[model samples]
Target chain A: MRKSMRITMILLMFLLFLLFLLFLSGCGDKIDLEEAAVPLAAGIDLDENNKLRFYVSNPVFGDKSNDVQQYNIPVTSLRESRSLQDAYTSGALEGRNYQVYVVGRKLLQHEDWFKILDVIFRDARNTVLDRMVAFDGPVEEMFAVKPKEQPPLPAILRGMVDSKSKRGTTVLTTLQDMHRQIYEEGLTPVLSEVDYDSKQKSFRLLGTALLTHKGKYAASLGYQESVLLNLLKKKATKGVNLSFAIPGEPNADVFELDRASFGIRKIKTKIVSSYSDNRFRFRVQMKVSAALTEQLFKYDIQKHADILEAQLTQQMQDQLEKLIRKFQRNRIDPVGFGIYARAYQYQHFKPLEEEWGEVFSHAEVDFDVHVKIISMGTIR
Target chain B: MNQLEKHSLSFLQFVFIIAGIQISIAVLSTPREVSLIAGTDGWITIIIGWLITSIPSFVVFKIMQRSSEGTILDLLRKKLGRWIAILFTLIMAVYLGAMAYIGLLRTLLIIRVWLLQNTSPFVVLLLLFIPTYIVAREGPKLLGRYAEVIFYFLFWLPLVYLLPMKQGRWLNLIPIAKEGWGPILSAVPGVLFAYTGFSVAFFLYPHLTNKQYAGVGILLANTITMATNLLIAIVCFMYFSPNEMVEINQPVITVLKTIQFKFVERIEVIFISLYIGIYSLVWIPCLYYMAYCLNWVRNGSGERKYLIGLLILIGIGTYIFIPTFNQSDWLEHHLTNFGIVVEYILPIAIWICLVINERMRQEGQPG
Candidate 1:
């Protein structure tokens, strides 16, 4: 009797396992990739009526027409917007292949606009590594313009930001990166910026947008300035080509070369912060190993390399000092000077955590730049 | 079944059983809870909590050494009356049952959120019990083997956490102890919840083959628990900024979302699914002890019958009342508080009583 009971129990368990698998196969939201609307990119902006405008671009494959289908809706939350888009699309909308999330300047201006993104960070299904791009105008306008030669807006936008970041012209920001920066007390957030050029009827890669922890837009950096920001933030190392006119010479203007260009072979930045006399002082020293990539004027390479290096060093020092003053004037630390202070001088920085921006503006800063032209090209 | 000593556990088995029981569902949320209180100073708090929990564990080991009884129930039956022994056994059976139930519920909750969103919790709970019953019914010796095998199988989990460190910021841990020692000390009680499974030493000591090394084994178990919690907390602390850490429900698991391979996406889903193996370590032992407690109440009779009965009871109990996430959290909150009394306080009290009684009885015998 006991042996038969044991046998019956084993059979019952085995049968139950089979039934569980079948039930699971039939239960829940069963979706096939072929019928699903996989969004490649999402654009969010504030419409003219002050409503939230969400744009989703889904790339169609194997059909050859309607190559990229777009959806536009005005919703209050990301979750609602996604569900509403799913209704209009042919199949359920999914973001597993999502590559980009763009926000417009008007929406970023609102201090609480980041509150709408709670669903993105909270949902386990959403991707956190997707590129986060901030645009100068309506995101819809950028999404409306299809890529002329590239596959679609998602790949084109991603490539634009990535290439610029490689050359140190912009900072590549992702959802996780922004989340960290916004939450960290010692650092502020910055996103790669793009602008829609109506005349050119194309999208251009703007430099970067500096934002507060609350996601409010504070200031912007141009392409040349973003290189300096990236270097100081330690986000980029090589491939930054610096082009500036020689000081005191309006334009040597040799041939068609506009300015001298130096391709950075190596670069290093060191920051030392100390507290003294009821104030904080910071010293920023930069060392650069550069190759003379392009020269506007005919100069002797062997005889004038030292003179060129000295001149570039002085010019870079002045530029860096001016940039520091600009950040001070704006009362922002996009270069993460506050992080250095808090890291190296915690005793003095712990009390002033909330007022770090104001304290940073009042602090004294010094700059030193050293440049060595390691290679002057094959010609010179 | 022929000779009880044949079912005894080696020192290594004893250590893994303690380590396995200590490292279940609690490790997932420990980073979040510690971060909420102590911020980045959580790693330090984990070590301190480890040292504090070792105190009760040491006392329990001492009690086991002083008594040569086959189990704590036998010790209690000799010192106290049979009724008192049975009463304590019932209490322990209820406590272990509740703990196993909570662990099983939390595992199903995580699976639902991450992997099987559409599967009913009842079905998932039942499915979890199959492997659990298979391993647990063989007694502690086989349970020890299962723990050993699972340990080797899942040893790579901690290394997987290092993948997310590429994007982590070391600066998040700076200004250490910024809130002073007040927060770290206060968070110690919270950290002790993660170390509660060490109480299993009280029951496992009689089954130890080499009792001389049991002390070292339990200490090693505590050290493993400490290291696991410390590694997990520090990883989450460095991966997410202080403010973001607070916002996340389980930074340890959520941080895994960023790790993607060329062929696979959503690795956390795969991890949460495979984590069923580790989660079983909790319920299997707890269920085994609950069954043991029931058999002790019957003076060590009908062990298998009692094990099957308690398993069915747990299944029916879970099915009748499935806890929502909030309710499950509420249960864990109460369990942590109740567990401290049972896991730490009750053992120490029993140790003190045993010591005094032994001293008084010795004095009378000498006279």
Candidate 2:
């Protein structure tokens, strides 16, 4: 009787398993690649009416007529905008393939706007590693720039930031990094900037956009200052090239030869933090071990190498000081000097944590550069 | 079944059982809870938590050593009264049942979020019980072997976390003990819960082939658990800033999101799916031991019957009420409190009572 009971139990379980597979397969909900509106880029900007606009560009699979579809709607919330996207697309918007999240300067100039991104971090589906690009004008203009002889705009934007960042020309920021930076009191945030020239119908990758703790745009850094910021932050290490005009020389031709250029092979930066008289001080000394990549109108290299080094050191020190003065004037700490002060002098930094940017603008800051020309490249 | 030999479990299997059970759903969020209190110095609290937990673990090992041929229930029935023994059985059965439920529910919740968004949690809970019943019916011999096999299968999980270490900043970990020892010590009670499964040693004692090495086995188990928690805590701490760490629900898997291979994307999804394999390590043993506890309550009468009955109860319970994520978290919190009473406080109280009672009885006998 027990053996028969066990046999009956096994059969019952088997029947239940079959019943489950037949009824609850969940296979009917499967979405094919073509049926899904897989967005390549997601953009946020302030529309002409000063309303927050959400945009997504999805590529059409196996059809070139509507090669890519661009849709924009004035949004009140970020994630809710995904549900309203079915108005234009054949299928629902899929966020899994987003390669870039383009931020318009108009939206970034407002205060407390970073909180709109709460859905991005809260939802598990949104990609965090997508590169974050700051567009100078409306992000719609950026999406409108469909350059010929190129890949898609999203790929171009992503590759543009990646290539410039690798060359130490701009900073590489991601959605996750920005999320980290806002909460990280030790450092302010920065993002890679891009501008479009309608006359040329091309988008240009510029330098970094400095942001305050409230996610408001503070100031902008050009390529040279961006390289200095990268060196101070020690993020970009490979292919950092710097150019300088020889001191006291004006351009004598339409093509000027007064400037010299060199690629940075090895760079080192040291910062010392001290507190005195109710203020903090940082002595930032940068040591550059460089190889000359290009030199325009240099008479002799092997002879006056020390003179060149000394001259470059003086010029570079002036430039580095100028960058620190810019940071002070803008009341930003992208170099994260606050981290050093907090780490070494905790008691003093803890009290001023709320307004470190304001206090930093009034603190004592200094910079010095040391140049060592390790090689003159193959030409010399 | 009759062909099975005495002393069926090896010493290493004994250690893996404790290690596997101790590193359950709690290890995934240990860093987050610890970071909320202790900041980046949380890894140091893990060390101190080890020192605190290993003490009680050793005491439980001592209690188990007194009765090598039987479990804590047998020891209590002999030394303490039958009523007290029954009381321990009922309390512990409830605790272990709650743990098994939470482990099963959490696995389903993760699956519902990451892998199969549309599948019902009750059906998946039913599916998990198949293996739970299969291995559990054979007793601890198969459970120990099952844990050992799963251990070797998912052994590379910790190594997978190291891939994202390159993008992590080391500055996040510095300025240790920034708030002094108060917060670090307060985080210990939280880690004490992650260390709760070591109390399972009471039932695991009789199954060991070489019972003399049980003490060393448990010490090794606590060290293994501590080392695993330390590695995960430090990795999560370094990868996310403390402010970000506190906000994430499961920073452990979230850290693996940044790792992209040429063939795969969102590796965290694959890891979360594979994590269900580890869930068996938790529930299978808890199910069997819970049955063992109730069998003791019936004076060693009907174990398999109680096992089947308990599994059915859980099956019906989940069907009637499919738990959301927050509900499972509530269950986990209550389980930790009950586990503290059953696993931590009761053993020490039992050890004291057994010591005093033995002294009086030995003095009267003059042995």
Candidate 3:
């Protein structure tokens, strides 16, 4: 009986220790739910008063009785502070900081907006990397314009941005992808610009906003050019349609590129150096796959497979060359030419850093594209 | 020998204990330091160091096999004089004791960082040591058996990390041997530390039913451990650049944190919990070694109560002395280097002296 009592006492002690450990496990105090607001998206714009205007979207829980409601707050001068640090010193409104934000689409042309991005990344409380977009006009107008029928504005925007057709070219830019482009020497940050239509009360994707090497506004690629950019970057998904022309046809032939199975087997870049004038010549060799979508010529094109292949290869090669020339003319090294040069010719690239723009502009480019038309769809 | 009473562990269990000891906190962080010294050729040094240690590990097992019923303490005393044997035994005891203490502290620190942030250090240490002491007091056979059970937990941890394998870059291990052989040669000391726990087999040698299989068991253990460590090191290098790894104190735990499961919120928390079993696998053996050494010191007639008291005191003393997480880190770094010397060099030196003593005895000469 005494021994059993000792055993019971020891067991009780062990139980107490376990309970104590459980008690000490949770660290911080519970946050008041009512005081906190979960911001799905936010927008920052410089209003006419020349003060920073912050617009936040607070998501409201939907029940059977209540339709989904979103609260929008347009606060001019987010706290009466002058400096950026002082501006946020008043603490987040309702214990929520800006989770996602949009800058005025015009601000993408200013190049100085990247400095604002650096500040956002440095903040600790902001955890959500939901979505970010650049608006064509004031960011406030874009946030104020709501969709007519949707589960929620955030969900609708998320669906549009996450859609494969829009993701790479016309959707929100992820922080990780943006950071990667910003740090890479030749690669430029391609952000999606949004324009608000007051009549439709909706947001329209205005294609890709390109940030220059110096973090300035370089140029914007329209919808067609943005799709071409996505294909070039290999970010294009399956079911993407690419239209090219047959040799003598006025109308273009469309092909649905199955990017999932597509392979860039090799990209051989050669830089032929001319020591006399310090001029560099570039030669690029690309291997890609093309799936035929439409047969422009009605005649038995199956027998003329080689002819069709040649025409398609020549057309793709011409288009790629034109795109490369456009990039060079804009003084933008979108192909990571500088990275390639550093990897191959370190000595030449060291002195060419200051004159990279001029060198890139004057460098002659030769394209050797090997487009293997694997299967001409089910038809032919 | 009755079939039912035959005291032997399966080959897998033996491998688990061996690999468990080898893949400690050292395997997680030592690769970065090794990289600093060996540059891109650190993995090569690790392979070479494993080979260097494998030779001694085999020889130690061979020596144990030659003695049917005696432990290393008995063989050492027979080969050398009593005083020298006792001296070596004391050194090994101290080394093993320090290893257990540091392992416990580091395990707690990892738990504190990854799981229990609010728990006091004393509470963490107490919770960890209580279970460790209970297992230690149970003796070597139970420790080995416990290791067999916990090995499954240890096995699944790497798979948790494999979730993020798509992000790993094979190019990170590229430009191999670009920094030359100078750093590779310098990294040998740290590389050998990962293989230190194979020496624990010496203390548990007499407990094995088939002593001759000891060498094979240890060799298999060493090979498995070296392979696991190599994979971990390569994966860590591929996941993060050398500069990024250098900034992290607990690279392995941090690497686990980077892994996100679709259903699970934080994989590191699961890793830290599973890692408790791994720590027990190492701690039990070390504590058993200390207790075994204490038994030898008492001429194998020590009271059970006295030994338990000594074990508790040692646990408490080490816990108190090595206060704070930083000191524990320092203790681990310095003791690992110290362990290589005492656990490796001292044993080989004593073995040489033992062989000489046997030769002299066979010649009928008393020096």
**TM-score for every candidate vs. truth?**
0.93, 0.94, 0.77
Best by the TM-score measure: 2
lDDT tens readout by residue for model 2, B1-367: 2323553789989999888888874778678878988999999989998887777888988888889467788788888888888898888888887778777878877887767777676667767777787788888788888889988999888878778787776767777888898999988777777777887788888878888888889889889888888988888887887677887888988888778775876778888877888777788888888998888777777577888998889888877887787877787777777877877788889899989999999899975
Ten-residue stretch with the least lDDT total in model 2 chain B: B1-10
* Residue-level lDDT tens digits of model 1 in B282-311: 889999999989887777665677778877
Scored on chain A only, each candidate's TM-score is 0.91, 0.93, 0.73
Q: Where does model 1 sit among the CAPRI classes?
A: acceptable
- Give the residue spans of candidate 3 off by over 4 A: A1-12, A24-57, A62-148, A165-200, A204-240, A245-248, A251-285, A295-300, A319-367, A375-380, B1-8, B37-41, B241-261, B299-328, B365-367
Share of reference contacts found in each model: 0.47, 0.28, 0.11
Q: Evaluated against the true chain A, what TM-score does chain A of model 2 have?
A: 0.93
- Quantify all predictions' global Cα lDDT against the true fold: 0.82, 0.82, 0.62
**Model 2 CAPRI rating:** acceptable
lDDT of 2 by residue, A149-224 (tens): 6678788899999989988788998888888788777788999999997787788887999998788998888898
Q: Every model's Cα RMSD, please?
A: 2.8, 2.5, 6.3
Candidate 2's clash total is: 0
- lDDT by residue for model 3 (A70-157), tens: 3333343433222332233232334224334576654555555555555343322233243566667877666665555654556656
Q: Who is ahead in DockQ, 1 or 3?
A: 1
Score residue B258 of candidate 3 by CA lDDT: 49
